[model samples]
Target: MMRIWPVFRRELVGYFATPLAYVFIVIFLFAMGASTFYLGNFYEGRTANLERFFLFHPWLYLFLMPALAMRLWAEEKKTGTIEILMTLPIPAWASVMGKFLAAWAFSGIALALTFPMWITVNILGEPDNGVILASYIGSFFMAGGYLAIGSCLSAATNNQVIAFVVSIVVCFLFTVSGLPLVLQVAQAVLPTPVVSAIASFSFLTRFEAIAEGVIDLRDVIYFASLILLWLGINVALLERARAG
Candidate 1:
């Protein structure tokens, strides 16, 4: 934790040192608000819940998370500063976790700033705030999962565009894994257990479970494991990249 702080602090500030942070926040806010009001029929539906708001997150993060993750390692390589940073007196794990945590925290900030929507709902009528809070929690974990994936994919190449493309493709596959259409295809050839396994990997399934106030331990564990698994891959990829 001690060794990771400086890197975390540096990376977090780096986000805001330019217009990228503001741009990201603005885009996120616009997407959320527009999706809720237009596609979700926020006014027409007489409800105080943010169900419509949260529902669009998986699709929203599909494009956004990769954009955030594409620069983590890709920019380091592009500018040739990765060599200096890699040789510093820091554990590779520390570097990996620090960068990832910084990115995750940035994601959390973006999510938190959407609280106005929550506030708007409360003013209109009584809604279960607990469910809204749980949805926020689930969304952050899901963002971490997406960012970790982006981190690993970014490490595999120095091209940010390529990193972004690969991360989108991978995240999309995970998001659709549990959909009826995907399940239908998997069950056609795969065994029952294999089909079930594919369904378990679905981000939408686990996220919806939490968003609906079903805070089961299994759903939480699934997101945690997803983040850890991809982050471990991130560490391994960075180690190899540093060596080469």
Candidate 2:
């Protein structure tokens, strides 16, 4: 825990030490605001629900979360700092947890910055704050899951651009698995139950429930399990790399 603190601090500080954090925040807010206000017609129609805003999150995170996580291990390896980092007195899992938490928290801040849209809804009408809160929680967990995948991929490569691209591809498939395009493709080659089972693994399927104000325990557990599983893989990859 103590070791984790320093690592967390270091990673968190690293996020703000460059233009990446600010650039990401600005673009995130702009895209979210534009989607909700302009494309979603929230203001023009004066709808109180956050449906439009929440709807855009999966697509938004599909790209943005990977960008946020691309540097976790890839940059370390590219700079030849992976060895130095691994040699620290901290446990590998602790380091992984700390870095994961830092990236997750950064994504949380970006998500939180969308609160003005919430304020807009409340001022327009009586939006359910409970539902809004649940959506935010679900979104954060979804982002964490993506970041965990990115972290593992980043560990497997020494190029940040490659890490970012691979993470985006993997995360895109995860988000779209439940969509008609992917489901249709799966149904053509697989049994009905198998196709349904594969779609059930989609991030969108779980997020839709939360966006609608229902926090199913299964969805929460799924996201948590995803993060843990990917982080475990990330640690193993790094350990293997260290050994080889």
Candidate 3:
């Protein structure tokens, strides 16, 4: 943990040093507002809650998170700085954790910027602030899951575009695994228990539970486990690159 701070600080600070950070935040905010107001019919419903706001997060992350994560290790490798990073005394796992945490923190900052939406809902009517808070937590965790997958893929290739596209494809699978259409197909060929297991693995399933103010321990565990699993893969990939 101690060794992780320098890398964490470096990467976190590096984000603000470039225009990429500002552009990403602007795009993310605009996309969320547009989706909520237009596609989600936020004003038409005249609802007090942010159901429409949080509903689009998984879809938004499909594109946004990968774009943010595509630079994690891809740019390093592209510029030959990865060799320098690997030669440092820090263990590969520390470096991986550090980088992942930085990306996650940046995402948390972007998510926090959506507070005006929360405030708007409150001004419109008496919204259930508890559920809104839980949804924010769920969204943050879901972003971490997306970033973890993207981080691992970014480590696998030097091309940022490849990293972004592949991450979206993989994340899309996890996002839709619980949908009725997917389950119907699985149910036809797979047993009930097997199909149920597939549903449990879906990001939408876990996140929806938490978003609804359920905050189930299982949902939290699922996100944590998924993030850790992908980060472990990320570390292994970095270690392999260092060894070679």
The lDDT leader among the candidates is: 3
Candidate 2 lDDT over 73-142, as tens digits, reads 9999889887788998999989999999999999999999888888878888998999999999999999
CA-lDDT, candidates in order: 0.92, 0.91, 0.95
lDDT of 1 at 152: 87
Q: 81-195, model 3: which lDDT tens digit per residue?
A: 9888888999999999999999999999999999999999889999999999899999999999999999999999999999999999999999999999999999999999999
Tens-digit lDDT track for model 1 on 194-218? Answer: 9999999999999999999878899
- How big is the positional error of residue 25 in model 2, measured in Å on the Cα after superposition? 0.8
TM-score for predicted model 3 compared with the true structure: 0.98
RMSD of each: 0.8, 1.1, 0.8
Q: What is the model-wide C-alpha lDDT for candidate 1?
A: 0.92
In candidate 1 the C-alpha lDDT for residue 31 amounts to 95
Query: What is the descending lDDT order?
Result: 3, 1, 2
